[model samples]
Target: MRDTVIYAHRGLNHAAPENTLAAFAAASRSGVTWIETDTDILADGTAVIMHDSRTDRTTNRSGSIYDLTTSDLDTIDAGSWFSGDFVGERVPTLRELVSFLGPHDLNLNLELKGNTQGRDRSIRLVETVLEELRRLRPGTRVLISSFSPLLLAEVHRRTDAYELAWLVDKGTIGEDWRSVMELCGATALHPSTAVVSNRCVVEEIRRAGFGVNVWTVNSVQEANKLVNWGCTGIITDIADQMVEAGRRR
Candidate 1:
């Protein structure tokens, strides 16, 4: 009800390939001004939009994202897996996504993927993402979330230019939600829908002075329930439905 924003989770993946430009465009067309996407670095230290460490699930290529350079990533077909309608779509760099969303006044929820390679690589991921945000879209509202405390801490250490949110599961928030938030210097919490579907927990998180944005909420009933409960944001795969649900409140 009260300005509960609907963020398109992975850019409405039900309609297009996840994390691709095609998916982002589809979400925008569906009247979504907020989109959530994953960010991982390539071998060349280029920040790119991708959900998985490997390309097998989303693209025609076969290799770990960290092993591939930006050129290697661009050569693969990223859209065909979802449908032929998105045939020629290539993987987009974070810079590309930022440039695309900046002028449109669209907000982004960029999830930072952990560097499976090592600690140095993880620090680099944080640096690369922050540098992109500072350079490409300085004035834009971007919320950065991650389950990795190391990564979030790295981000917090480098810059506080953007809002940071700690992503947590049911067990992770048991009695230490505030502690976790303080540890990462995060002002927000991105809890799994399975964990936060309980209205009491949502109230608890809000009472702790942390904004709650639940993830992957797709159904209108669920969306309405959360919005009515005064959740700050709902990350959904069905942005249109959730937007309508928010309006109904």
Candidate 2:
């Protein structure tokens, strides 16, 4: 369960653009104990921090991130859309971010992009990412997750696995939820904000011996309700507030 600590979703995403260095640095300063982020490889096979296939929502541009080279990625304005003060912020590569934050002993949750077409590419990408982690001056507390089962399985088959989680948006629980998750050696269940339909879903996952962590929950009340139902932790936009709220009660 990685210490049952709070994970700042895309850093302090509610206060800054998601997946930007400034947002992550802000989250670190805000007293958050953990942070979670997304990772996708560029056209050149450079891993970049991003949450979308398109840069439309967070940056001042419209294009697939996968289409850009790492150098080309620097030309885009990732922060200006959030505010003028952040106009020239460049997109960060995954290894760059790891070097920036890895020393703080913060827990990290890495969501694999699942876009690589072949099993070899998927494993190679994850291998590269982990190799970077290994080079950190201080070891990292890391977890690898993916929406694609194939990618998840590739990661599982190849290396010294971290806690793998299945990232589901629609709560599909498709085919066989347990079967699918079990195949990847998943230790947690990450479903969307809307799937907190009943306490049972949370309880069920936990009862089956997996940690339950929900994503992007910001409201204190919304977060409190989930914590009250026994969630292990929450990945939230308002990291400090959510942690404080959880601690208050």
Model 2 steric clash pairs = none
Question: For candidate 2, what is the lDDT?
Answer: 0.78
Error of 1 at 157 (Å): 1.5
Number of backbone clashes in candidate 2: 0
lDDT of 2 at 116: 52
Name model 1 segments beyond 4 Å from true.
none
Please give, for residues 115-161, the per-residue lDDT of candidate 1 as tens digits. 78898888888888877887555566888999886678778887888
What residue pairs are clashing in model 1?
Answer: none
Candidate 2: tens digits of C-alpha lDDT, residues 30-136: 77867899887777888889988788988888988768887887678999888887888878888888887765556678888877546666666777777766755
